[model samples]
Target chain A: MSVLDKIYEKAKANPQKVAFPEAENEKMMQAAYETGKEGYIKPILVGDSTRIKELIAERGYEESVFEIIDIAEESYKNDVVARYVALPHTMLKEKAIGRRMENPLYYAMAMQAVGDADVTFAGIDNTTGDVLLAGQMIIGLKEGISTVSSIGLCDIPGFEGSEGQLLAVGDSAVCTNPTPEQLADIAISACDTVKGLLDWEPRCAMVCYSTLGSGQGELIDKVKEALAIANEKRPDLDIDGEFQLDAAIVPAVAAKKVNRESKVAGKANVLIWPDLNVGNTAVKLIQQFGHADAYGPMLQGFNSIVCDCSRGAPVSEIKGNVVISAVRAMGQK
Target chain B: MERKELEAQIIKMVAQCYNADEAKLSVDSVFGEDISGTSVMMVGLVSEIENELDAMIQLSDAAACKTIGDLVDKVEEEL
Candidate 1:
């Protein structure tokens, strides 16, 4: 089965509660409705409850299919805010928390923070900035993760590599150019993400223009440091690197180029690009020229499963993402 | 360096990091909206300023900087 099929199967087997902060958004609602209908996820639509119910009813769907959190309701809003403030290390006054809770995005994050929801999904109407800020302030980053990043899957049409035709790439959508520390975090997050989403024993390669000592530059140094940091932090994970694309995924090239014992060099199922430039361009090339289907850029490194989809993404892609997020939430919680 | 020159230098550095139009940048440019990728760019700026000025910059302090002015203020305090 395909990665999406496998993930969807997992999602179907254990549908997690995915809270949509932008519940009223057309594409988001459609995707949530479809995912909920398919039993891949239990959608918790957070926004104007009346309108949400109207949308559900208009679509010939049962209102019983969704659990709508009426952001408009005064008592429920106050209760969420109260619960958020009462969480350990909130550091925000009740009034301050209540004030920010006016935004549905913050409200959803607050819900996740206080266990009212499982996963917080957004980024259609809200900028990535708004989502990240809410996630940072409310849900907070995972312990030791300093920034939020993303991971995506690339299923190349004709090219077979590690993990079959499926390979995972990261930091393509959210971070612009990751620093060494952020890159390390991205690598670790990518490993965990694939493990959660694909159930693969992650062999991650930190990619660059060089493979070992074949080339040298400041950029190569950055990739090297990233691998070091990732290895130091999570020694159990098979995260290795400073490999070129060939060395990363091609066994022959890896044998010729990589002079050290590295589990990830040839058998890498996860390729962590050194920066967003490499990641974004690589994914585009694969999609346009290689005729591959790019799966994510799903946001990671948060305390909870947080996601950000492109505003222009279609409802089908959104459903796939929701399914991906649901399966991830299943593994995480 | 005087505060004026320091702010100007930081702004130019930030502009370089962002690859944004230097003419549009200012102390008031919000980190998230104006700069878009604050974590990476701000880390670069902090490291650049630290190396060029021989000043220590904490990444957490840099992360806390919400605006270009806030970053400049942090640099000044460090200096």
Candidate 2:
């Protein structure tokens, strides 16, 4: 099966409540409706109840398909806000938190934070900043990860790698220039995302400009430090790096350049780019030249599955991202 | 490393992150407004800076860094 097909299968098999805060946006609402109808997710529409109902009528979808959360309901808002203030370590006053809850973005994140939703899918009606800030201020970051990052799954038709034409690349959409610790966070997040969605063993490679000790510079040191930190942080996973793209993916190149034993050398399914400069450009090239379908840049390192989709993404692409988001939220606590 | 070198590295990173001109991004450049950055982008930059300095930056402290200079000062204090 194609990687997307596999992800679709997984999402269909285990449908989760993927909440849409931008339910007022017609395009996003329609995408959420279709996603629900297709059984890829049990989409929850979090917005004004009457408007949402009207949207459902206009869109001609069954209202029962989604569990709609009425953000306009004072009682529901009170309960969510009370819970937010009551959560340990929450220092924000009730009035302050209530003001934030008025925004659907924060309300949706609050749903996921309080266990009412499995995934908080946004960035359509909301800017990337609004989504990220809401997620941070409400759900907070995961333990040990200082910041959030993302991972993209590329399915190149002709080129077969460790996963048979599917390769996961990361930090392509976030973390412009990661330091060693942030790189480690990206690598760990990428590993978890791939393992969650694709069920792969996650042989991740820390991609760099050089292979092993073949070349040395400040850039190479950053990548080398990232690999060490990742290995130390998630000792259970197979993550090795300080290799060029060729050395990371091609067995012959790895054998020639990396003269030591490694688990992820050449046989890597996950490619963790050192910085966003390399990452963003590489993925664009893969899509343009390799003609690959790059699945995501799925946002990671949050306490919940908070996805950030492109603002200009079409309805179909938006639904695809929602399904991918739901599939990733499958095993999260 | 001198604070000047540290400040220069931060300017370089902020420039690269936001596609802003490095010369224009002073330590006073407000993160969201000045550099056209978002909360998400700032996290990576500050956390990376924290790691570089091996400084412990609390979440609240990180949130308080509105300008690049504020972040550098926080890092310096922690260092």
Candidate 3:
């Protein structure tokens, strides 16, 4: 079966009330139909209803399967803007009023805030910055969460019908140049996310251009400091840093190259990038050039749910993202 | 070096990294030009300038530096 089928099966069996904030697109309609048909989610659609109906008819999608929320008629977008304006605090209402962009992410976030939906995913039709700003402004960041991160589930097929193992790579999407504190939070948060998915404990490797303290600078120091902080906070977490790809993943190479005697040195499942450029570029390289299948740029460390998908994502990709987002909102991932 | 000289040096460094026509690569020359540098190459250019010039610049600053002229101007200010 395909990945979507697997996710669908999982969702069908799950008792959680999953919700998807749909757009005026075919992919969302497809997922809504499939999820609703399977009783996997009480799908929520938010967009231009006429466009959605046209697309649904064009795709032969069943309209009876999902609940559609049209913003133009009900002025749902205006309602959210109004609510933000009515807030007693002057600073917040002013800040909300200043956001001139009529992005749908704000509406989606408002849905989550009011318990109208359990989770929301959008970034296919909007820029990453727009989606993030809406979430930050409306839902706010989680407590003790100073920054946001995007982790990808890298699932590559192994040789001879072996079960494919997943690798979590992160801070590659949102943060351009994270501070030491932010890096530490990224590592810890990524580890927590990974622990929810896999049976294995997280062995985080703070990937760098240079391996194992060979490079000395603010960037390297940042990783080192974050590593120390991560180790200190989660003493049981197996996390190491300032290591290159080979040193982090290859047993013999790590043993020969680095002297750090830790569980994360050779077999790190979660790899944190030094910066967004490196992290984003490296993940794309692994996905496209290395022929690895990537699942997310799953936005974490937010109080409300918002996941970003590639602009060229397929139905399966959207479904998988929805599942992950739902699980994250439910505090499972 | 004078501010103009520093800007010129920054442009020269960027041109060398980018392998573009030095004259065409003025402070105002746009990055990602068809005959100019790609975002990837521009990143290298930024790194090279940083290391050689011993100056600190955020990637955001480098990204927002639209033209070679704009880049040199930034280099001058940062330096």
How does each model score on TM-score? Answer: 0.81, 0.82, 0.67
Tell me the native contact fraction for each prediction.
0.04, 0.04, 0.00
Candidate 2, residue A75: how far the Cα is off, in Å: 1.7
lDDT of 3 by residue, A219-313 (tens): 78888988888788778788887898878877788899888577777788888998888988988888776677877778876666677777788
Restricted to chain B, the TM-score per model reads 0.89, 0.74, 0.78
**Per-chain TM-score of candidate 3, chain B:** 0.78
| Single-chain TM-score of chain A, each candidate | 0.95, 0.96, 0.80
lDDT of 1 at B39: 59
Please write out the lDDT profile of model 2 over residues A1-333, one tens digit for every residue: 666787888889989998899997888888898989989999889888898899788878898898998887899888888787777744245765676677788788877777788999989877786677677767877888867889898989898798888999998987888879889988998888888888899999998888888789999999999989999999999999788899989999889988999999989999999888999999999999999999887988987799989899999999889998998899564
Q: Indicate whether candidate 1 or candidate 2 has the larger TM-score.
A: 2
Ranking by TM-score: 2, 1, 3
* Candidate RMSDs in order: 8.4, 8.7, 11.3
Q: Model 2 Cα displacement at B73 (Å)?
A: 17
Q: Name the 10 consecutive residues with the lowest summed lDDT in model 1 chain B.
A: B38-47
Q: What would you estimate as the lDDT of candidate 1?
A: 0.83
lDDT of 3 by residue, B1-79 (tens): 6877876887787777678767865666767662353333454565566556755454568778777677777777777
Q: Over 4 Å off in model 3, which ranges? A: A1-8, A15-22, A48-59, A70-103, A158-164, A209-215, A233-236, A258-260, A331-333, B1-79
Per-candidate local distance difference test? 0.83, 0.83, 0.68
Q: After aligning candidate 1 to the native by TM-score, how far in Å is the CA of B31 from where it should be? A: 9.3
